[model samples]
Target: MFIFQAAAPGTSIIRRDLGAEPLPQTEALYAVALASPATLAAPPMGSLNLSEALIREVEAADVIVIGTPMHNLTIPSVLKAWIDQILRVGRTMKSTPSGKVGMLRDRPVYIGVASGGFFTGERANQPDFLTPYLSLALSSIGLKTQQFLTLQGPPHWIGARHR
Candidate 1:
């Protein structure tokens, strides 16, 4: 399991700016045999100069975990930046006549999201651009198996919970 941490908890600007309580300094991950038959390795992936380590981690992780806060009804810029690093053209995927095809092996992605407003279920009141966008983005890399865990309520509910 790899905690694809876009921002270290200690320096997570979103959490700080949102006034959320400090995240746990030490986090642990356990992995189960999350597998798929996706083993198509045709388009060789290029390792981004700076993101090579991140790409390696993604390849190694059987289960990937990302914890993020939805900002402005979508993902924070930090998370977006991280995604840009991993979404390599020749590396993670390749362009085909039909469309883009992913070359990396598939894995389970679990996303934990914190939102200031309710966007789904009966209490839905706001437009939800987060989940759909993430679903599309992640699926592009062959990470089709995904689950979202959301915690929504009043603004700063995340902070209050930790405190």
Candidate 2:
């Protein structure tokens, strides 16, 4: 896989399997809203909270690599939940008079996508909401530099017919 190939001498890799791990709960949004001010003022340390854990991961990473399959033209709900947990106001971004501004320093993000059906160029029949949405989300968190690699074909041709 891409991660394995990307791994080399002096490179550190941190992997989070969203499907296997217990994602943040819906209540996490409320918790963030309540803790935003305090967190912004003095960031927590040694916290075991899931949201905090995810935030720390993003903060520590130099380059983020995500590999995912297209599901109904968008990312899975679990990934969306992870996004909600990480995109904390005052922590990842701030609301200014002009608009929301990202606080974290920009970094490069590489997204590998696999699709059963074509979603790019003139042959595309399905609308691609994933790329644009993810771009905006990452940018909101100050990760503006992004590279996307996609493999598109028929379900059977791509050996994804089981899905």
Candidate 3:
């Protein structure tokens, strides 16, 4: 699985625990995958146009995992930047005369969210942009995403256990 951790320092800790290598941010990664022979072989995909470099990463991996610490009620800009790259038109996805068609086959995406407060429903303790937006956006592009595995510290979610 390719882990896209929005938190850098904490992300390294998580990566070490999981025994997985984190993928580089999209730009540096772009050139490696877009090498001459590979691009030449696949004309249907013109991923060179995307500067965000996320498309190459996503296409290369069979599974994707995202680790994030909720900040100010939203996802970090770094992760959002990656999303911008992968959601390219006529590349990872396309709009056609018929309708929107996702070129990517279905892949599983696991989201690891660490938050100080609870925000599962309408009665949100804090504004949350992680769960819903991630679910929707990933679904839009043929990724099967799941609700977060929320690791809430002792202050919250410690007393309750859901079935």
Candidate 4:
């Protein structure tokens, strides 16, 4: 359920060089119930074939790499929708007294994030909501180890913009 963005030219964001299966960026719109009795009852699967396939990919992959653009200081709606599709009730995770516990095996998730403003490092001027939110979201599904590489201020942040 990765609402991924297209990778930069000559860059392989989805490949970890560990024979990781590469999943194409899912641009299709996805908005469905996060969890249901029918889906939760059996093996966690999406009501739609697309979501089901996405879930299976994530499950099988040894590592996950996501390339996305920060939209308005948060993830795009499409990404959120994709996330909703994968975070299943009984499949990817389960509700426990302590909290929602993850059922999937832990893995490393590398994310290449692009931003128009500085979210970290020196001369910071923006509130970074994307990192924390993504951390919690991915961790909920047992993808504990994560590394984020951000390209901030792109071509638009130079000279006067920096000053």
Best by TM-score: 2
Backbone clash count for every predicted candidate, in the order shown: 2, 0, 0, 0
TM-score of each: 0.65, 0.80, 0.59, 0.70
lDDT of each: 0.65, 0.78, 0.60, 0.69
Question: Compared with the true structure, what per-residue lDDT tens digits does model 3 show for residues 1-163?
Answer: 3223453333332222221333335564454444455553453344445543446667666556677867767776666766666765556666678755677778767788877766665345766677788776776677864546776443555666221
1 versus 4: better TM-score goes to: 4
* lDDT of candidate 1 over 1-163, digit per residue (tens): 2223443433221222212443222111100111112322221233224355667878877677778888999988767766766676566877679777887898988888887778887777789899999988888888989999888877656554321
Better by TM-score, candidate 2 or 1: 2
Best of the candidates, lDDT: 2
Task: For candidate 1, give the lDDT of residue 19.
Answer: 29
lDDT of 4 at 53: 63
Query: Order of all candidates by lDDT, from best down to worst?
Result: 2, 4, 1, 3
Q: Which parts of model 4 have CA positions greater than 4 angstroms off?
A: 1-39, 42-48, 156-163
The collision pairs in model 1 are 45-91, 46-91
Worst 10 residues of 2 by lDDT: 39-48
Query: In candidate 3, residue 62 scores what lDDT?
Result: 57
Sort the candidates on TM-score, descending order.
2, 4, 1, 3
